[model samples]
Target: MTIESESDHILFLSRDLLDDIELQRLEADKLLLKCSRLARLSGTDEIKQWIKLEMEGYNGSKELSDHYMSRTGRWTNFAERKGYWGPLAQIEENIRVQKLRIDVSKVESLSGDGLIGAMRMNRDAQQALANGISSMVAIRSRVLNMLHTFVAGVYYERQFAKVAESTFEQYKKDVDALIAAHAGEVLEKLPSVVARLQEGNDEAVSQALTTCRRIIDSFADAIFPPQAGTYNLGGNDLSLDANKHQNRINVYVAERTDSKSRRTRIRQNLSNLYDRVSTGVHTDVTAEEAFSLFLNVYLFLGEILHLGVAQTKDSVMA
Candidate 1:
């Protein structure tokens, strides 16, 4: 199916990949191939690149140059473990702990009769096998999540675009000045963020993260200014503070009973992103991570702005 036509039936593809991953029916290479195709259909450019690294390996991907899986050094910790049973069942790493990239296509999987078969031999051959299949599995789950969100976004954007057309002229007249200033400033950041990231240096990474925070900060200020300390919601006073985008964003989302679930999801996504952005400010963040963080600001903003314009529908008509 052509990209446009098959998009209507994307859920089918999503479910197929889900089934494959859940059942462990496909090898990492085949699974990544499927995910890469699925991702190309509806995922963002950045996410598509993330998947590409798995399929093609980080051989020549400049954006992910820092994350190349060249040295699979067992990584920060438990990553060195070959198997997980009972006490070894769980694996945890710090969120800041970066995962080593692997080219799933290259990993040679051990095939035998489960535990009994796997115990039969110890290859101890990382150099020989180059096991990147597990990293491929992570991509499967990620692709599923990104697909769901991207498909939903496509639907939302279409529905909102229709309303936006009918409501645009009137809405602008009422709230253009205040909204435009923040929106314009936010838009202006796109170029600066691009320039900084292209530099591909530590300082550039920091600048990119700072820009991410600025995007959130500007969006928060527009929707829920810190100057407005108390948000009177259903007559309950919820507090707000400067630079505290999460609380302000939650308050913004809470105002909409009809969409609190989706809006809250968006807020939480941004909240998690904000934390990552904050972490990058203090720690070393790759250009890849910084770019992804910046790319996401606009994703949530689309839903937020759609709801935002709806919030002004009555005032505009009045």
Candidate 2:
């Protein structure tokens, strides 16, 4: 798989991991390696350390759980079977089975070979399970990887609180700011939206979609209007496209904000809202979908407006 950026690679790896997991065709060792890479990218020491431990497995016999460290088997001597340690103790001891030292490599080979969850090897499945090696592999691939939540950044064991805190609210804020500046018409139409939704007509959906388009177009107009010129970005003089709102937003936001993640948000929200609502629907449109369109129109406006705000603030300061 050829991927470009760090974020793209992360996204690709995660998608690949999830695809295999959901399909239940998981490559246990391969999944571990991807998870390890993801954990490293997580930028948290705790997550990294945990993944490291999982990949390395138990250090030595001392660290291995007693359950796996030794195997218990009942030994029988037919001649002396009766009451050697008395019936009760003898039965207890016979049933109890003596614990003997076992090699970690014996059970561990299952995981090392990436065979888990019904995937058997030369050894009997039940016998291999006795060491709990498959369980450890599952924990690393399925359990630990799921727990990491590297994309979200805050979860059972990790840091990156700042990124976690800013998720939806930041998106909402961006949309709100955009609406305030460029959605005057949409706002006026909003008073009728509830009634329109109640009527359950496709017309309402069209109206909602059109309103979204208007606001975004207005937003684009406000920030980067149609101009027959080029924007000199660093040493490159990139010709401006009158039609490509994404390009405009990218250049503009990239100029103002140092945060690549924030720029990503602006581009994503803008593209989704603009592309989704831009095209008219031929099939039946539900009031729920129309309401969703309306909700998205409002929420997708603010961050773009934030760029404008920053520009205004800078101008005033100058």
Candidate 3:
């Protein structure tokens, strides 16, 4: 048969390349086993003599003839004249052909087996890809959380700072007015009276007053607190009733939209890949195409997973 016809026949017989490999391997192994058994039964000396005769001819050297006679216990003249070499040579040639067939079969089998092994490898790659994707999603969530937490803390701190600054400014104005009003009576006691007046009665007001004093003492503190370094919106407290409720609604809507889009894309890609693989396996595509598809899916999954992991790390840092 033509090479193309043979290949087509093989594809028709087995959809999977692995199945073809396994069958050829099995056939080769059987033939090799048969040959080994035949060799054992025939005896090594007999086999050697057979090989020697096949190498030489019936009218070969006396030395070779004598050696063959001694090993097989058959006189050279009787063996040669009766055409013993002819039958034995044919048997040896058959065995050699069998061995060659076995070897060739095994090579072919292994080629197909390797492809199947590659397919299995792709599965591991796919899993890794999935894991990577999941990890990235997790990382993104974490980054977002940290950012939220930072924002919340900053917001609260800024609000407190504003209140404190306002209170301090008012206190400064009041002290100036009191000093101006009592200027004639207590010129020397102005500082002490201003200090007393600045100290508010209520606990919250007192705290605000203290904070204002600290800000005034250190101008840097008023602009930026030492503890609040960077603003991150992730990992912010989600327990605030109004903020929590609003965020929940937003997250739900976002998740639904993302889920729908992801599903549609994945389904479409899978369908396209499936068609390519199927066509390649049977007719239009070559062995190379089949191999490529397997590799493509494997690589695609891995890339997705890698992206996910990166996103995850970014989220964590955030």
- RMSD per candidate (Å) reads 18.5, 18.5, 36.6
Which clashing pairs does model 1 show?
Answer: none
**Top model number, lDDT:** 1
Clashes within 3 Å, all models in order: 0, 9, 16
Ranking by lDDT: 1, 2, 3
Report the lDDT tens digits of candidate 3 across residue range 212-248.
2222223222112234222222344333232232233
Q: In model 1, which runs have C-alpha deviations exceeding 4 angstroms?
A: 1-182, 232-237, 313-318
lDDT head-to-head 1 vs 3, winner: 1
Where is model 3 more than 4 Å wrong at Cα?
1-117, 136-140, 178-190, 193-318
Candidate 1, residues 126-146: lDDT per residue as tens digits? 333334445433434454455
TM-score, cand. 3: 0.21
> What's the alpha carbon RMSD for model 1?
18.5
Q: 3 in model 3: Cα distance from truth in Å?
A: 82
TM-score of each: 0.41, 0.38, 0.21
